[model samples]
Target chain A: MSVTAAKGFTAAGVAAGIKESGGEDLALVVNNGPRRAAAGVFTANRVKAAPVLWSQQVLKGGAVSAVVLNSGGANACTGPLGFQDTHATAEQAASVLGLGAGEIAVCSTGLIGTRLPMDRLLPGVEEAAGRLSEYGGEKAALAIKTTDTVHKTAVVRGSGGWTVGGMAKGAGMLAPSLATMLVVLTTDADLDSAALDGALRDASRTTFERIDSDGCLSTNDTVLLLASGAAEVVPDGTEFTEAVRTVCDDLAQQLIRDAEGASKDIRIEVRNAASEDDAVEVGRSVARSNLLKCAVHGEDPNWGRVLSAIGTTGAVFEPDRLGVAVNGVWVCRNGSVGEDRDKVDMRYREVGITVDLAAGPESAVIWTNDLTADYVHENSAYSS
Target chain B: MSVTAAKGFTAAGVAAGIKESGGEDLALVVNNGPRRAAAGVFTANRVKAAPVLWSQQVLKGGAVSAVVLNSGGANACTGPLGFQDTHATAEQAASVLGLGAGEIAVCSTGLIGTRLPMDRLLPGVEEAAGRLSEYGGEKAALAIKTTDTVHKTAVVRGSGGWTVGGMAKGAGMLAPSLATMLVVLTTDADLDSAALDGALRDASRTTFERIDSDGCLSTNDTVLLLASGAAEVVPDGTEFTEAVRTVCDDLAQQLIRDAEGASKDIRIEVRNAASEDDAVEVGRSVARSNLLKCAVHGEDPNWGRVLSAIGTTGAVFEPDRLGVAVNGVWVCRNGSVGEDRDKVDMRYREVGITVDLAAGPESAVIWTNDLTADYVHENSAYSS
Candidate 1:
């Protein structure tokens, strides 16, 4: 139970011919109750998908009765006709659910620059609406996968009998600003749209925006949070926010673990920077270094590449004052060789890199994967 | 004849036993000049190698008598002792050549975080000095190879008896702010240090700074232009500058062609931008996308990846007004499907990508290489 883990939510997943492999490519989640408060975040990329543009407008009204998502085509870079198709999709969903089109949000994922198979998609929406069930959350999670090896879901319960649950799908192209992925979260708490918006932004700012797998930003990334108020418990704002953050953090970790062609999950922790922004900038710079990533893949404990990466950023740090550690061994101290690199064991799948800027008290964590030949193979033949 | 192609330059390459493979690892180029006027550029990376820091200070005086380069060890991140080693190398060369230590520049490239073998390196410097010959440029070029498949050299003759020639060595970590390479250009034209400085800056700004092989900036990149004034000809300033530019451009192209594990040489041209800066920003963004590079390697006309990259920049462009052409075929027009993608042919080693922002009249071109599985293999085990 993903979205349906909370009360007042029903979901369904249906097979549509949109996917050439005939996989389940359509999903629907409905909020059936006393409140329809909602909030959303979209890809920061200027060239957004048609559904992203449509859903952004729908979310502006601070309410969403239903969300319709599909895989197999991103509906991005399809121009005016694509926007019209998205509108038609929302209209079809609204007609079946007896709700206004403005209350329906739409999402899409898959190959970019292709038109969706509306012929199958529109009818599949009706089928999905007919099959809506409170226990259909698992199916809904399974329907929105493109290259993900497994679907991701997380749940957190509040002390006051409220809960937050979410599902996310992403395998690659995960970078900052926001990971290139789709996420939907549901909560059965008595909260207004503003409260949901604040909680979602705060949670996503630190969770979805920290994992950078390949540094490629996508055109169809979206995250939405819908509240139904079925539990009728007005929990403390701080507690609600913490619950939402916990769920988002769990989903983010799951996405990183399932990243495309990744063999080792690397955690880059930047500490002792002058500010949080500096820490983040340094962490991201280190995370994006293909050379450093490859070194991590080989488990060479190459700290020089880390220093080289850190030097490229404008973050506040002194070259001579910097320190680096691989795993638990301090391989570099005061910008020079420190402990024995051979002492660091990298035989495990999880690799930790700690960078000490030695500037101040701020820190940031960034998750990434090592570069491998499998990654090159996966991306090279993806479109073919 | 590379550096020796110009007058009044003697060079030699010697195997210093510093390399485990017993390859030639030391090179020396001396300017036997009536004028020792010179100009140099170093990597912008703040965490610079010891040799880069020493050479930077030497070039500040606008005069250089000789340049000593080593390929077995970068001597980076080795703390205070690394700087002392570089100073010692320069001092040994100066003692042999009977010049001030301040006039001897040093450059080193190889595994980072390692110290040079001063015992062998000091002896090799005297040997290189003794063997310096007018025909030693080719040997000097061959000595600077770390992972380069082939040595690179270029020459351009001015109209009035002046000549410009150079040698460059780099195969990876090539990115802007300057490609991660070491270049030494020799000119026999009668020009002052200020003239050589202006010409070298103008030439490298357009040539070496525009080729981004793998988007990794190294800590030990350096480019130097030395004027000997042996031709006794005050060639036309414009002609001399053009000659220098031509040689630098040729070397830059060779670096891209020999990029590590690259299969296709991609030329990305961003046109009709709001400014030249915007064009460069867009071109670099697209050139650095591993997804697009992999697509190019697979010979897939994935214009959508190009557009997605452009959207991530802050450049001025309307989403629908964008256009992309792969291999002279306009596969995406007005940000949507245009002519048939099947019309595009990409069976050769050269791939061309033209992105029309359609926002203004400015344009810029960037050269890069396609990503391949071999790249991952080479970098993963580079140090080990």
Candidate 2:
């Protein structure tokens, strides 16, 4: 059974008047498994949300029974008053669930620098705590969404019995170099916080951090992993690690797929760099490229933009050592345009380009969405 | 007497096979006067083009009697052979015009890494020489077009009866720090190359470098300025320099106005920054922001994108000391969302945002285009 499919986990979503449209604004989830072990990953953005700070420190103690999340008002840069509001919301949830305030985690999304509507939020959290159930994953996922088009959830079952479930929410303000890794992971296997942190960091590098669409990291990013140890035995070694990665990857892809007004997802891979660090820098250079992203949106395989991007990195390399391929065709070789580039088909819903530095074998890949008009339309309508 | 209305300058345009549509593909300009003094600025992109390398060395002599330019091919990253082709193109232009090869300069625009169609180009250069005219400033501008929807040209009169007329072409490959700065400055003023270079660098810093919209520097970038000394009077002080900057600023603004699919022109001014460098960095940081650009496109007034972008810079400042305003309205003060944010309006076609670091009097201003779908459609179509 999936971790979310385990016993006594309930969720509820309701409009708490944070967003102007008054859409789904808050979510609540409680773990009543008879065993509680929780861990989390927060945003690397130095300017973090009050909720992120609250959740991160709470997860340090290793036991969490509930998570209260809200979309539409990211309680960030709201100073001391914001933190006090977060504390009040968590306390209200604790009072309703017959648990201490320290046993809860809080997550907030939406416009930054805004304080929470404490009166509405407190009641919302209390209602969420009262509605906890075994099949509330869907509601919780829906409630945590901001500009995301759809709810993001992933469930995987391990051999011998343990299952891991996770939910994520983010659309824009994502460059997550661990953008908003805001995640709630549930599992029936018991892993200590140290083990969870190790797994989380590894899983995130290849997944969340790969969504480099806009290069803007969010203020509220939290990823929490809770284990009940209800399973007899968890899967072994790379097998278990692979499962965790799979869950993380799925959630990450959804984040990109649902990126604000995104028309296409472009994956850029740089191979043969001098080192992995150089490779990551090269990949990131291209990923953060507005020109490259715009070209991808227009279906133009402008390899020149690709080469220009790589040239900006401080990494050392000969210009001639660079080679570029678009959608599997060698578009450039030895730093010059390759032969028969006209025959290459760059039109695709999903485009992949590879830059071969020819400096070494170390490589990395980054995932991002094309910059489009809709991206602007989706973002400019109001001050969120 | 504007530079375009100046004497001793003749221009011509022709449809070489460079552009697929067979529009005006080649442009030529000549100084009838006996003396020719010129200076140039090439792309700082590490992957320099063959023409850039050729021109940088040629400028040591500080003179160019004529220039040959083509649209549709940047001729960048073409390696050793590309350099040979550039020299050949120059020799051909010289041969056709009965002049020395060293007297002519070459500029290319279009896709990078592709070789020029020398067979068609050689004959086209000869054909263009036969078509030169004093009214050729317009023709020269058109001959240098690329993905840009319009041609960019500017002319200004310097002191002492000297005229400084210039033409520039660039759009898609613009960003801060620099982009395609292909310019031809013609004047009767007699100035040394050293003086010209110093003035050009200063003008560029305040203008071209401030218009970084896409954040990607191009390989084909070249700003070629020539002074014929036909009027034979060099203005003392910064008069000539100011004229150059005025033209550069006008052209730079035009490029931003025509940035691909751009729906709005945004001016981000950073005031009260700790230092000029810090102010410029902060301005550039805000200008390079995709989420913020998108928000500006949507007219969303999402100040969170603003504060988040500021936090990414190395510029030291307390978050609480930051103040952000939209269209003169302080939406955020002391790091928190201000009460008057809801009263602000973002519906106008032109938008201005101000960020005060509350540190010092130093300030900087950056001009950028909003991220739009047309930008996507234009870049994605096929320059691969």
Candidate 3:
């Protein structure tokens, strides 16, 4: 269950004819709300897509009635015309749903530098609105996939029957500051925009923001949260936040598992840092090292590459005090070779690496994918 | 002609049995000098290799009689033992060349965290010294190759009958801050260590330090200059600097052209920046973009990927004021589609990308390579 798992939210997916393959490529979700509270976090990329720019302004109103998304064209680098297309799409959705255009949020995916096929997308929005239903969550999830091999959805039930659900689509161009993906969450818990913002931020910080699949940030990344207050249950802030985090974590894991052409889902945990930020900085450095990723793919447990990556970071650590473990084997200690690398088994699809800074008490974990021939094959053959 | 193309240098290469392939893996270059002034620069990586640390100390003496380098093991992360190995290699070279131990420099490449085979290496130093000749420059260049398919060398005859010649070897793990490579330059100009340092630093700023092949900086990157003053030519500082720059530019181009598994050598030129530093930053940001590199490999002029890479940089620029060109075709103008993309061609091995910031008058160029399946194949099959 995705958005429809929560009460007061209706969703639909439709074939927009924007995708040349003739599959479902448009999704619409509407909140039938008593309290229309909403919050959103968008890509930090200065070069944002058309929908991203429009949705950022719409999110400032602190209320959202619906969201329209398509997966055929990203509508980035199309200049003023792209922004106009996004505005018109939102206006079209507003007219059909009898809502204000400013209250509608829009998200887009697929190839960048191309304008959306407005002729096909506008009519498809109307078709999606006509088919909106509580059981359409799975279809909506399926419609937003570009290079994704599987659709992602997560759900959690909170106190007093309150529910949180989310759907996300991303396969590559994953980096910090949101990466290249779109996410939407719906909740039936009674909460204000302030609570939604706080919960959403907290959930994303340790989940979506910590993954680096390919170390390439996208211009269209977006995460949105909407509360309809239809469950009529005033859930505690802590419980609601945890529920949101659970869904985000699930989605993040799914993204990593399905990262394009990735043979190994690598978990990089950096511990004993001077600060939490230092831990993240060190973790991201290792996560982005192509050398380490290749070593993981080869099951070589080459911890020297890990040390080199750590050296690039501005983290507090003595060179000789650093330690590295691969697949639970401490292959390096005191920055020197320690255990036998052959003892580290990486035959599975998941690779675990832990870097000990031996400096302080802070820690962080970052998820990434290994560099494989398949990753290069998939990325090199296509433009998206 | 390589390092020995200069008037006062002799070189030799010998098989040290350090490489599993049983190829030549040890090199010796000696200066028959009237003046023995020397200058050196090493990897900026905080996790420096043992040879780098030792050579840094040796260069501080402003004199060098010879250099010993091995190509099968990078003496990094081996702790004190690695440092001892480097020191021993230098001492062995000094003994063979009849020079003081403190007057020798050392360098090493290949896999990290492994101690050199001192038993084989120390003996090989004497063997190489016995075979040293003015025509052994190419042999020394060949001995330094790791995964490189070629041996790089460049020579420039300068004003007043002086000459500058060099050799470099790097195929992978290449990035800014020197890359995973070893370079040696020799000159017969009558110059002090201070003059050589000034010219070497100025030449490298726009050459070796501006390339980003895979964005993995190695701990063993080094560039050293030895001035023997045997030509009896007191070359002008400006002329000497120009000759050094010529050699550096030639070697840098060779490195990019021969970058491991790369099908496209990409030149990223960032122009119209507020400052030279900003231009370099922006150029490097685009050069390191895997997405854009993959696009270039696909022969797709996807300027949107270029804009996305630029957005990640802190260089001064407005999104609406940016323009991008691929292969001299202006596909994007003022942050929007400018010309028909179908008009562009990308069938060549060399790809050129120019990003116009429209901010000011400064510019910089960074050389890089496209990501390919062959690259992944080479990097993932074994640890290097």
Candidate 4:
């Protein structure tokens, strides 16, 4: 059960003929709750899609009764008509669910600069409203996929009998500030909008904002968390925030695992930084180094590229005091050759790179994928 | 004629057995100058190669009498031993040429974190010194090839019988601050060290500092300008600066054309920005976008990706007022659909992407290459 794993939430997926292959292309989730509290995070990209713009406005009220997401058309760069299309989508969903249009949020993904098939999409929304069920979370997850190989879902149980669960779909254009993905989360905790918003922003900062697959930010990234008071348990604030963070971290890992054309999932952990910001800055610089990614793909344990990447950042570290390890082998120590590189085995799908700044106690982790020929082929052939 | 195209310069290249393939890997350029005046630029990367460290110190005196460059071993991240190796190489060159070791500069490019084969390299320096000739500039250029397919050289002649000539070698790890390459420029203009320094910095700012091939900076980039007053022509400062800029620009273009595994040379021009820094920031962001580069490789005028790249930068521009064009076709105008993408033809080896921020009148250009499977293959297979 992903979003529907929590009480007072119903979801459905339907084929709207938006995708040429006639696959499920539309998903709907409704919060039938005594309390309609929600929070959201959007793409930092200024060139947002129409749906993103509409949802940002709708979310300002801190209340959302329903969400309508679709695949096969991003509805971006389509001029003012695109905004009208998103508004119409929300209106249709609101009418079918007997809610105000201001209480609905809409999201779209796929090829950008295209208009949605409004004729097919409007009818599909009504059909999806009729078929909404508590067990339809998996179907909703499947419908939101563009290039994802599989649906991703996660759930966490709070000690006070509250539940937090979510689903995510992303395969490319994945980078930080936010990955190019759509996520809908549902919780049965008795909380106010202020609490939900605080928890969500905190959780997203440490989890979703740390995974960078290709370093390409998109115009359509959206994440929403909706709370319903069906479970009368008022969870402790710390417990509720931890649950949200756990679920988000799980889904973020799933996104990285399913990143397009990836051969290996690399974990870059920077330690002994002067500050958390410095640690994150160093991690991001290493994460975005295409040369280092390619070296990981080749399993060469080329630590010099790692140093070259770290050198580009303004992080506090002495060049001669730096240390690097690949697969638990200290291949470079004090910024020089240390152990035998042949000792590091990189035959597995997961690789670990550790960088020691030898400056302080702070640390940070950034997840990324190895660059492969298949990545180039997939991206070059598929126009976004 | 490259470095030796100008008067008062002699150069030679010889096989040092440092390269496993046994190609010419050692080069020497000597200034037979009535006045020894020079200026140099090295990589901004903090984890610099040993030779870069040595050369930076030599250039501080502004009187480099000779330069020794080698391929097949970068001698970087090799700790104190690497520094000693560079010192030994310079000492050998100085001893052979009957000059102080402080007057000699050194440069190396190849695999990082490896020690040079000093036994063969020291002997090769002696042989190169014995064979130094005014016509050996071409041979010197040929010696510095790591992955470059050809030697790059350019010359600009002044009206007053003075000339500026240079040679450059780089094929990968090219990015701003400087490309990962070794360059030696010689001029016959009667100028002092301070004048040469000012001209070299001014020229490099707009030339080598603008091209970003793969967004990877190297630890061994070095560019040097040596002035010899043997021709006794005190040329106008403006003319001399222009000549130096012309030669640097030509060599920069050659570096882009020969970028490893590149199928297209892309010129990204950002116009109508609030300031020149904004223009450059916007252009560099677009140039480094893997998605945009892949789209260019597929010959798809995916202007949405271009807009997405621009959105990630802090450059001043309204989302709806931004514009993008590919090869003269305005695929996106006013941040929406403009001309038909099919009208744009990318069937040639050179492509131009223009971004209009509509913020101000400043502009900048950044050169880059498209991402391709061949690029991934070449990088993954190469250990460095």
Candidate 5:
């Protein structure tokens, strides 16, 4: 169960002929709600896609009835025509659902700088709307995939009589500020737009915002949440927030595991930083180093690359006070060789690297993938 | 005629059995000058190698009698022992050259966190010193290779009967803050320490400082310039600076062309930026984008990735005012599609990408390499 796992939600997936591969490329999610509260978080990238621009305007009033996502054309850098195309998609969906266009949200992902196939997309929306079902969450999740090899969905059951579920689509261009990714979350709990917004922002800060797969941001990144209140149970803010965080965390890990061409998943934990920001900065610096990533892929246990990456950052730390560990072996201590590097085993799909700054107590964990030949081959094999 | 093209400079290359491959891995260059003025630039990375630390201390007096470089191991993160190894190497060179240890500099490159074999290294230093000759520049350049396929050298002639020559060694870990590189430049012009420092810094700012090969800064990067007044030519500062820049530019281009496993060399020029710094920032951002680099390698005119990279930077530019051109074809104009992407050609080793922010007249260019499968294979094939 994905978005439709929660009560008061209906979803559908349709083959829109948008993807040249003849796969399902259009998804529709609707909230049959007693309360139509909504929240959204978009990419911070200035060069945003048309759907993101339209959704931002639709979310201004914090009320949403439906969401439409397409996976074949991003409708980005297409000038005014792209914006008009997004408007038309929302209008067509709204007309089919007998609702206002302003209450519908839109998201698009695929190759940028292209106009969507409007003729096929508009009719596909009506077909999807007619076929919408409460058990169509898996289809909806599969339809919004570009380069993803598998569909990703997460669900969390609350202690109260409410539930939260989400579906995300991304395979490449994954980084910290988000990439060419799109996510839709649904809840059957009594909540307001402000409450959803606060919880989503807090959940996303540590979950979706800490994965750096390739250090490439995207112009079409969006996450939206809709609350229907069909369960008639108002959850405590903390309880509901924790559920949302859990789903996001699950989805984030799924993205990293399925990142394009990755051979190993690396979890970098930077502890003893002067502050949270410093910890995050240092962690990202190490996570984005191509040398370190390649070494990890080769299982070389090259901790020197880690120190070099950290040295490039502006974090407050003494050079001689730095420490590093691979797996569980402390390879470097006090910025010097500590243990035998040959003893550190790296023959696993998952690698753990810990950096100690010995400056303060703040810490951060950043997930990244190793750079490999297959990654280069897969990325260069296609333009998306 | 690398460093020895300049008068009053002698160099030698020797094998110390330091490299397991048994290649020449030790090099020495001495400036038997009427003037012992010197200036050097090192890596900005805080976690410096022991050789870098030793050289920094030696250069404070603005007089260097000789330089010793090794290619088998980088004495970095080895604690006090590493520093002592660097000192011992310098002292051995000074003894052979009949000079004070304080006047000798050291540079090391290759695998970090490894100590040099002093038993072999010290004897090799004396052998190199005994064989030092004005015609040994080529051998000296060859001896410094790590993963480099060929030796790199440049020579610039002065109108006043003086010359400048240099050698550089780097293959992988080639980033903007300098690669795991070592360079020794010698000039026969009449110049003091202050003038040499001013000229070297000015020349390097726009040349060596603008190339980002893999976005991995090194802990062992050093560039040294030694001046000898044996030619008796008091050339103008601008002339000397221009000559130094030409040699640096030549060497920098060679480094990019011979970078490890690279298939395409990309030159990103950001134009119409709000400021020169803004232009540089945007250019570097585009250069460092792995997705864009991969797209270029695949010969795809993916300007959307270009805009995404620019969006991640803090450069001041309106979304609609951005423009992008590849190989002189304006593929993206006014933040939308302009020319047919099919018209853009990428069947060449050198690719030119120009990003126009339309914010101001300032512009900057950053040289980079395309991400390729060969790069991953070459980098992961060896630990260093």
Candidate 6:
């Protein structure tokens, strides 16, 4: 419950009235002090949301003191008017917090195309700003969700006061390489923008981009990291970077856990790939496979679907080099159908399938949800 | 119904006793010579079935006269033993017809792992050979089905006496660049093996390769085109190829119409790409999107899903260069949300979406089925 437990940040969440449900949908967080160095990551999708556009430009200055976020509308594909709204929102937060407009980042997520309801949103920003406290991290996590049923937050403590705390939200429209999930991380540890930016990218490679159940990347995907220099010590190289990465990985798993209509959270691990990309490609191919998802949903260990999904990856490998295991049981080996397929079970809410290429030693893992009747029912009627 | 109507072949379909139902599960087709030319197309999946392995070798020789197919057990992943089964099947057919084993080919599709029930199959094969007729095309087509609910056949008559007639069966395990589909074509045209090969490749490029729904390429996919030379006339180059391609397109549509558990057949066309590959990459990207498929199933004109799928194609493009039309109604333009989103309806079984890249004049089309709850049920309990 304490943001300061991991060092340098205070956060707060407030009911913004921006959401129809009147649930908490706005948050503000601050990084007090000496080294306000920060780095930000934005969705690679070309159809950037208005907030992503504004924040990308703001982060170019290499530091940020506070962030303001609103949930309920993506403020994307709304033309030039959306850009204006995004800027005004950031400016209002900057002025109220007695900071430069260019020093405060912004993000928004929810339904796409609708303009921000500034009448209700502007006042909510003031409430969030007033509630900012060192113990407000949990509330901040609750304010960034759309279809998520639970809040997601993670904290990693390192040597000294160096710490990494992060939170994210997304369920549907999720694919890695920037899932619709939005994330914000703050640390008291001092680090250069280049170092933080590099670390964020490296962390995202396996964390955010590896969950491709629905294969849809959101326009508003963003993750920002702020280093407040509040921590007296900054661990070097792998030590601090790994700590930051652990937080991202933990939060990513939480998002997968909340995937829409998901009855099972499946961890698809691909081992012995010729390369990490190959391993990831193979894993993503299976993760995004609707047929394979159905197999998992039925508690049917249908590995043929698994092999079929792997065959789609353009990676070079003889079929005989493949091996697959489900729930710690080998179902295929030496490049042929394994005899123990019937022995595998998947009656639980969590399933794991380990695919071994047996061609190389590298490995990768992707998180996904099963394709269930409810997933079909929910998405089919979503827009209606 | 006459395979000889295309001029060069005879066909027969009989109960192979391979299927427990005792239905017709074996088919035999022979090229009546003169045009003993064969051109073959197989699945692109690296993990090919035993028949795929045999056919790949057969095509290398360029001279094939007959094909024997069964539909009770897919000779795949049975390992080296699987290859032996295919060889034995082909040799038996060759011996019964007084031909060399090299002149015969084999294809099978059904439950994986379970070996073919040959006690009943050997006699079924001889019975099928004895029943061979110049007019058994329909039966041959029907015998190769696994889960397909209907028979698909097409005939195209060109200038002079040349004609192309064929059959195909594919319902599930579908993705393109070969899904789990089988196609056999017989023609009386006097084209050489090279020309026949060229036409089949061109036809497959725009036909079988375009049906990428589940993104699960099957191991047993095969397409064989045989010229029997019964027709004295022979067409060459683009014109002949175009005729061959049209028949393929027609049968491909049939496959889509009968895709497993599909209620809607969706065509995603991408235009004005930087290159044809780029366009195809984008189109295929949309076809494989489970979210889009679910939306189509629900009759939801969710253009956001369309944009998100295209964004992941890795094809470089300006956001504003993109436009989307669902059922001929523009739902998005200039990368901004379109006003007609509420107007595009996908209630019908045939739904079309045109995605304009505006990058260049290259274009590609992908045919796919909308994902539904029934699809999940069908595949999940396939083993049951």
lDDT of each: 0.90, 0.77, 0.89, 0.90, 0.90, 0.80
**Tens-digit lDDT track for model 5 on B1-384?**
999999999999999989989999999999999999999998889899999999999999889999999999998988898999999999999888899999999999988877889899999999999999999999999999988899999999999799999999995323443248788999999999999999999888787888889988999989899998889999988999999999988998888898888889899998999899999899888988888888988899899989989988899999988999999999999999989999988999999999999999899888989988877776665773
Residue lDDT tens for model 4, B263-296: 9999999999999999999999998888888888
Candidate no. 6 TM-score: 0.95
Predictions: Cα RMSD each: 1.3, 3.1, 1.4, 1.4, 1.4, 2.3
Deviation from truth (RMSD, Å), model 2: 3.1
True contact recovery of candidate 4: 0.73
Clashing pairs in 5: none
Clashing pairs in 6: A176-A209, A177-A209, B2-B135, B6-B188
Predicted complexes: DockQ each: 0.85, 0.55, 0.71, 0.72, 0.74, 0.61
i-RMS for every candidate (Å) is: 0.7, 2.0, 1.6, 1.5, 1.5, 1.6
User: By lDDT, is 3 or 5 better?
Assistant: 5
Candidate 3's clash total is 0
TM-score of 3: 0.98
> Which 10 consecutive residues of model 1 chain B have the lowest summed lDDT?
B171-180
Off by over 4 Å in 2: A1-23, A31-38, A59-65, A172-174, A177-181, A229-241, A342-348, A382-384, B1-9, B31-35, B172-181, B342-348, B382-384
lDDT score at residue B130, model 1, on the 0-100 scale: 97
Where is model 5 more than 4 Å wrong at Cα?
A: A172-179, B172-179
What is the clash tally of candidate 5?
0
What is the C-alpha lDDT profile of model 4 across A278-326, one tens digit per residue? 9989988888888888889888899988999999999999988899999
Relative to the real complex, the DockQ score for model 4 comes to 0.72
| Deviation (Å) of A380 in candidate 6 | 2.0
Query: DockQ ranking from best to worst?
Result: 1, 5, 4, 3, 6, 2
Model 3 off-target regions past 4 Å? A172-179, B172-179
Number of the predicted model whose DockQ against the real structure is largest: 1
Better of 3 and 4 by lDDT: 4
* Candidate 6's DockQ: 0.61
lDDT of 6 at B21: 80
